[model samples]
Target: MPAVLSPTYREVCLWQEQVPREPLPADPLPHEVDVLVVGAGYCGLSAGASAATAGATTLVLDKEPLGWGASSRNGGMVIPELKAGPEKLAKKYGQLGRDLYAEVDAAFDHTEALVKEIDCDYVRSGQLYLAHTPSHTPHLRDFAGELQRSGQDVQFLDAAQVRERIGSTAFDSAIFFPKVGGLHPAKFHDGLAKRALAAGAIVHDRTAVTGLRRQAGGFEVQTTRGPVRAAQVIIGTNAQMDAAVPELAKRILPINSYIIATEPLTADQLQLIGPQMMVDTKNLLFYWRLTPDGRMVFGGRNQLDPVDVPTAREFLYDNMVRIHPQLTGVAVEYAWTGYVAMTLDRLPHVGTVDGAWYATGCNGTGVSLNTWLGDRLGKVVTGQEPPPAFAELKHPAIPLKPLSSSYLPMVGRYFALQDRR
Candidate 1:
């Protein structure tokens, strides 16, 4: 397959993905606001909601309708913590590891609370990381042990126990993290946007900002519809963020992640997948879960390509049937794809430049980390003390070098190979 060819996003966002929405009208007036947030994805919505609620005249704009990006188009697996475990974190960040973990835990809690006020169809059932191979089982155990040693709550399940929970004998072991869970991402973003609007944020969907320039006291944004002036600007778009800032665009590369939903299966077929969100032990990293409608949603990493509905559906039909042959007869009802902002370190970047602040590059953990950083960034903008946890993060400008522009494919292929091992 070509490196850039990805399936369409509509196919697998969720069993019942939110439908396309009409655009919100442009801001009637050009006025200065306390904060100007770009990208209506989770990060923007959360930050905009918090900022507007905190008494700032916040303005949020998106290229597509609200929740049209990866925020509403993702796997919906709410895994907490950095992709690396404590051992790797310590190796990479030293003393900062503990603080980061604490903040990640807090992020999980924040997501739960945010979901409560909205109707996102959230389920706190937690997540199960299954190891299909015996070799992978030790990694899960060691990671769970490290988490426990760091005073986090995680459980290790043996082969038989894993089968009991997942209804699959394909895995040798599993690690369950109650802090992580699943939800309907589309609903969450939409609900949050509404809350932000109610709290005084001026949201303009289908409004893409064409240019940004520094002005006297703050900045000026030129949009397709009109201009927005704000003392401070925020870029909340994650993986779908392309060219908002040239430096950030280099640090974060967009990769296509595809998913497909199977038609509602019979009770017998539903038994094959229990009430658990699963990420298998493969470099391909298949994460799947059973939808409320008894349909199976399966996702995997695919090349970034020009995608459409038909192409996405075909890809899902091929991929989903491979995981379970019994699902061969199960027709695919949807196929879709989304962009994830992938960083070199797989950690989110949260900082400011000039007078513009940004929280991007959540990698694949935008659902939790974006909301976490949104709340954190809101505090920073409001002159309130930011949580000490984020103090450990060293906000350096992402390098805009040749390797960043040219070597992403090579680096991605290497990491993909490692994940396969």
Candidate 2:
């Protein structure tokens, strides 16, 4: 961490207006409810709002405050494709693959509309997915051709074109997606929470769920506060998954990703970085973009396990400088970590596991997908609609089981090595 004083290394959200603060107050814990949604992040709260609107007595509970999870910590890039592109998904699931991609596309539109409804500094700015190595550029170039033939709003940019857009030679080439957008994640989370509350759902913060079991006629949720009975439950927790539901824990691996925000850049510096959200093709990839106030927020997951924020900040700063040497020694105003939920399939899953509904596995690009899936879950639980196609697919459990964390660092090291090659 740069020794330069910038409010004393507290883990500030940077997107929030206030500094570290208390969790918002909530209604009294309900002894019984029609729909119980765990986790108050984007997906959970969205489900709460929808369930409540559908006339289900809903309650959303969280272990931490409303805006204290990856939902707020994420870069707020609303890219609507799954980890696999439409073409790849089409190859995998045929017509259902195309339909799943359409669902994600609808998610992007829903997110845009919701952002507008909430007035959260939404920008319809396109995104640049850069090729991190020379070997990757040719693949992206060919992939861009595939996307174009399928009528995607995409373009292939050679190294020269990429430099014109990014002012960085760190990447070899890029694929542009004009439909991507950016927003204030914290605002969106808080706004969605408020919407949930206004819809007559109760949101309780700082309430940790210890266990959940289906009982006669409903499920009993054991929490740090007390057990609450619900006719239906949605295990909407993403990266914060714990042993509350062993089935979810078996499938979701929580990995830490760090982010650092530099002091507001100069006009000249912004010119160098360009005004678009960006990500790279590396296994341990990098994502960056300019905040509305011109601060550059750079994020990556070079290391998956826990590390002190200071160490992560320095590593990211070194990488940031390597990517844009112009930012060398720039004051890092904030550094924080958020967990990304990963599964063996590298895709988000929505299904009824262990007799409870769940939508986990964002794979690091879930701002839009989570909200959409959560909303779909709300409707599904309320008998308004069926589960999305993703639920019908098989959800694979990670190999190595409970001992996976012991060898996870080795996997991280291998990914870093692959990024180098």
Candidate 3:
């Protein structure tokens, strides 16, 4: 018999393999609901649960299976801040910036509480942001000082300290956030789905919402299955918004991020790399963490164009080896790619547009922010709370829609050059 070849792309990730399989809902889709939630990722599910709790008849619809997008595909780091530093944020919005920081801090606290309540394998191992070059150390220091002023518990580690903690000499210095941590993304997504279902929200997977039109009551949502007349509609399809909502698509530039997981490592290998979620200080960042099962999961940004799985796997593996040369010969067990929604301002936007509400544009920090926004939007729809402060910010559409794909590669190359310097 001819030798069997391993598949290049993984059908599912390591996190998906750990969680119990989610079967499609058996009940038929209702023709009407109080609130219709599009996209069953973290945000949608979170909104569904909160809406149901607030006595709204909520239904969540998704094009793929639950947790099919970045919710399950992310690096699983619960970062509470945006790409912008604290000082920049304070300088820009002043009091509003401080309020935004407080909200994100609450999100971080809520995430830890939710993880414990959901009984998932979450580690409070914290996170380390490494400086990729000597010149980056000052930036890290400034960032740490700003965070400290904001009441965040952060420490700046020198090269020797970084090596002691990370067991790698590739980084120059590091900023350690003692509150951040990692969790099983698929498991957390599953927990949210179950909570939503239990809270009386109907979940319909593999049911894509194609269009939305304002009607007499609220909006008529056109879906693959049928039309759903909802009193209100919330779009939570971050990064995967294709043709569903043209307005949202214009505001979000979807970029692909790839990840690779190595085979299970020994106890000694685990000790070499300390138990902390790690990321580098680069415009095009590289993030990595050890899974609960002891596998090294490393991820980074890739070219804007479509890339084959083998190529993505090779690229991620080379970067992983560059960080830790000892893992040179380790076999990669899984490789996958997911889309990240990038906005013009590099911040998340949550507000109403054209009679429909939305919470998206995570800009690479989605795990905690998505959960908070989803729940907060649900409250806003139910009249339980006001719109978040982020809703006040302007969300402008990208300049040229037809030529957007070429933009990311150019930006990535520029950032790569800066990292080399």
Candidate 4:
């Protein structure tokens, strides 16, 4: 479960980029607890914090130090629902689907509230989905209809209108959703972990959950440090859960997502880009926005790989220029990449396995979805009846192949080539 092979994120511009990281000690874990949660990212930490506050003896474990996974390196866009459009979700779940969206919207609200209460740097500036080509415009307009039907405040724009609002002629059209926003992901992750520790949750970092056994009344988990027995278990590992639970791993593909940060620009330069967060429509998508520190944080993914600095810089720089040619002259201050879990359906899998509980496969929607799942999983662990929406959810297994690891490069290259169209 160590993200030793996981992707890295840029170290400049982000609020928590080079902040002092808490060390995960080599101490042994105690033998028993009321709850044992795997993975110390947002979902695990949030779940642990809630459980501990409810007076449950909770313990959280991670294979590497905190902030070592997607939780820390993600784009921090807290989009308040699944990747599926409203029309699709409605067709799929009927009235139940609408109710589910409401639940997720509440999840996003809880995240903002928690950030404020914890004194984390959070914002509600909103997010825009930009369109670069004529063919892309229709999709954005259709998306606006679906978003409006979902009870979201969405505005569609033409090329001139978008250019006026964003100060860039790069987009042919765009969709703005006030409900979606951005944040400092790493800070939020660390803040949640700190609050969990303060509330009496025992968090073990650099600790890997090596084995699992079904006990008579509960489950016993083995870690690198020692063993832990608990009445309930939660898995918040996402795509990184492969070695820990192979069955769940096959259902989710871990893809490398890259991000780049520019040096702080002058107020005049920032004015050229305007203030909102924006992403474009392409099979291989890219998102670019101004950080609170006045630097541009741009990101997107076309494939999965073990990304390094050189490859990340080249890939991101080339793609960024296609959207905003003026940025061709801008210097890249930093570049990094991280792996995210993607499901075939592009929806998160939240359900129980045996007596073990789990919340994984957020696709690219992990920021808000993970927090929501964490809150829901916390309720489930405390024996409260889970919401009706989660009852019918199931994890569709991922097809495994002998050449799976080697499969990334080929799939990625194909998409990269196709994205240029």
TM-score of 3: 0.96
Give all TM-scores, in the order shown: 0.88, 0.96, 0.96, 0.92
**Candidate 3, residue 78: how far the Cα is off, in Å:** 0.7
Global lDDT of model 3: 0.86
lDDT of each: 0.73, 0.86, 0.86, 0.77
Give the poorly placed runs of model 1, Cα more than 4 Å off. 1-22, 27-29, 302-319, 387-392, 395-420
Clash pairs, model 3 backbone: none
Give a tens-digit lDDT track for model 3, residues 1-421: 1111244436357777677565775577899999999999989999999999999999999898777789988889988888887778889999887777878877888788799878668888989999999999998999899889878899999999998887799999999998888888998999999999999999999899999999897999999998989999989999998897898899998888888888888888889997899999877788999998998999886555557666777787888888887677777878788889989898889878788989999988889989988998999999999988888888899889778676756767777787786
Superposing every Cα of model 4 onto the true structure, what RMSD results? 4.3
Candidates 3 and 4 compared by lDDT, better number: 3
Return whichever of 1 and 3 wins on lDDT.
Answer: 3
- Residue 151's lDDT within candidate 2 is 88
| Weakest lDDT window of 10 consecutive positions for candidate 2 | 1-10
Give each model's clash number.
15, 0, 0, 2
Instruction: Please report how far candidate 4 places residue 225 from its true position, in Å.
Output: 0.8
Residue 265 in model 2: lDDT:
90
On residues 1-421, what C-alpha lDDT tens digit does candidate 1 reach at each position? 1112234333345622544555676547456788888888777877787888788888888888666788777777777867788777777777787667777788888898888898877887778888867888888889889989877788999999987776667778989888777888777777777888888888888888776788898888877877878887888877766655666666676767777776678897788666678787775577888776677888776433335656655665665565455676666657777777767677777766556777877767778888878767766776775644554566554455444646655655775667655
